[model samples]
Target: MTRRAKRTRPATPQDEHAIPLQQQVNVPVLNLEWIKSRLNPATLERLMQVWGLVGRLTFPPSSSGKAREGSRRIPTADAHLLRKAGIIEEASSTITGGWIIPFSVVEEKTNGLRRRWIAWPRDKNRDDPYKANAPLLHISHYLPPAMAEAASCLDLKASFFRVSLPRETRHLFRCRVEDGTLVELTRHPVGYKAGPEILQIIITSAIAGVTTVVHRLWAAPPSVRIDVWIGNIRIAGSKSDATLWEAQVLRNADSCHATIGRTANRAPRSTPSWGCSLVTHTGRYP
Candidate 1:
């Protein structure tokens, strides 16, 4: 029979202690609240704006194009601390190189505006057809106080996001009261350099909720005459492709209606031919 090797005993403390260069490593759990508490209101406001625009929890890119990895990585430690504080979670490897937090986690209300958090995608190659950089929140065109009062009366959902185009683009687009109006209703400004594109994304997202309506009129005429008017003035001339696309959506919505209302603005009336001119310019539709 082969001789059995003698069993090695557990290392004694002396042996363990004798091992060269022993050091205690202290890893501190991150405190998310602590970080948040330290942020000044201005900083917090900026952070929220960035969050809403991006729609994600993310850090600025490191020199290496990825977050630093390894024991000494400061961001990793802060991320871990944030995780401990229940702010976000380490996403699965499929997402790679970032932590993810729910939109609701960092939501805050200020000056009666409800801010939401959003995440930006890591890969530049990824095609987010819906523009994700548009502002997520916006104030409706200054509604007449009476109309505002009427808006308050509608049996509307408790509160839903609203989108509006700037006064200029509204006229150039010849946005009638009826067509592709949902795109206009749901779209909002993306408070970033890429905001125009992102408006498309938010509109696309809102569309997913089939129960939601996208028309400018929140409720049907019987409930309230839509006291607001969307135009194509500054909207048509704007270089933003998003504004153009939104104009098309509005125009389409108008086409579907039997009687599309004309804008009170003179530009569209001055350029009656301009109503269908976008198709030629955008190369989209006629």
Candidate 2:
């Protein structure tokens, strides 16, 4: 009989510190309905926690001086496991100055559930260079009259403008028209610290002109109630300057008047006395 080779296993520490305390905790208790109702905030937080845990174990920090900094920032071993599971892509660090991992790899890993999670709107390109630096835009709200009309014209459920940046600093602009013209925009950055801001301006500019036209065509009265959200993209920092200009245009359009009570002093009230369903955008823009 041939001699059997000795089995070998990689060393793993069993100390409490070596093992994360979260691993000891039971799976998080979550209500499906509650989660569905408020999915954005909670789900994202939970997912990030899971990703962080995975990163720590799979890519522990390197001991050597130059490699130490790189190791400290490496994604968890679980991230690699996730990549193997088709939940995320194999983590690849960028050659750019920042030690950030590219967003493209993350996107490839997450592609299986792309629709499940809201993504930043941008043109899909297999060869485009800045794929890694691009941010994901998440659409939150759709503005009225414009939103309804855009949906009707485009035959889309929703629409949004998206932007992506590459290592060369060139930007890519894309219009994502689902059932209507884009009414809201959101972004999720992957690797670079300034990536989100760079993409936001591109997206904002692309949509601003069209949204302005829509606002002009759908001017309503002040008495008409209007609720506007700033959307998911942040309008601060160096990018704020450009975003502010776009915001001004939106504000001007939002100030238009609809046919409400004749007197300026009179408070306009809904005549139908029925609450508007959030699911449908049938009534007049408010």
Candidate 3:
């Protein structure tokens, strides 16, 4: 009699980047609420000034190529616990042979003022397990060259990681605080290789229905278009239409629990020299 072959489960895909675990194999998740509760009055005020609606604070890089020290200092007792939880790292001479990544700050010139803190993690970050693929922004040549008509541009607040990261991915955000305490970010931290890509994924997923609605409702005749680029959402249409669209977008943002920036305008208005054709969502040519 022919023996029946035994079926075996397929092997799981192995991740190329594996995080190094310390004595504590299982890292505890950071309690942001608790940490916030512990903040002193002065520190809290400092945080209010520096931090945006996003939990991230953007500090201009000093000549040394590091984030300028903010006025607020984390409580010493909380700092130790945070280190143990993998929220910060100790700047040790021995670990990684005393290698530290320097930071550079960039100012994004949108309608409002915004800055970003960038870190040099080399080409491949050992901590980042997933591949970083930024979502493509809407790029149609036919779209208006300038904000001639009414347009609303909204910036999402605290837009990074509305969803929780997979347990494996959480280990990637390890960094050293000023006190030399090693910490891992429970929430998605800025200045990581995969941060923007992951955040884009989250934002796209959340606003996918809204995108569909915008596409379906706005026809070619009306010349309404919605463009999402990273944290910015731009809606182009007539003054009234744009206002209504902005309201719809606000509702969508509320559902997604995303905060919108107060500033909304047609800041980059077009010059009189440019050719003026009936501007459609697809632009004049289309």
Better of 1 and 3 by TM-score: 3
Instruction: Give the distance in Å from residue 203's predicted Cα in candidate 1 to where it truly belongs.
Output: 8.7
The candidate that achieves the highest TM-score relative to the unseen native structure: 3
What digit string (tens of lDDT, one per residue) describes model 1 on residues 173-275? 1111111111111112222344433222222212111112233332122322222112211122223442434344344333322112233222221111122
Tens-place lDDT digits, model 2, residues 1-286: 1111133222122321242211111112112232122223433354334323211211223444221111111124323322232222322232111122221111111112111112222222211223222234333343334332111111101111112122221111112122222111111222222333232222221222232212343222222223222212112112333334324433422222111121212211111011111222344355
- The TM-score that candidate 1 achieves is 0.22
**Model 3 per-residue lDDT tens digits across residues 118-193:** 2233322443244434534464432335453665555543333233333343333334544655433444444555
The 10-residue segment of model 2 with minimum total lDDT is 152-161
- By lDDT, the candidates rank as 3, 1, 2
Instruction: Give stretches of model 1 more than 4 Å off.
Output: 1-87, 94-142, 147-222, 225-286
TM-score of each: 0.22, 0.23, 0.43
**Candidate number with greatest lDDT:** 3
| lDDT value, candidate 3, whole model | 0.37
- Which ranges of candidate 2 are over 4 A from the true structure? 1-68, 72-96, 102-193, 207-282
Tell me the whole-model lDDT of each prediction, alpha carbons only.
Answer: 0.26, 0.23, 0.37
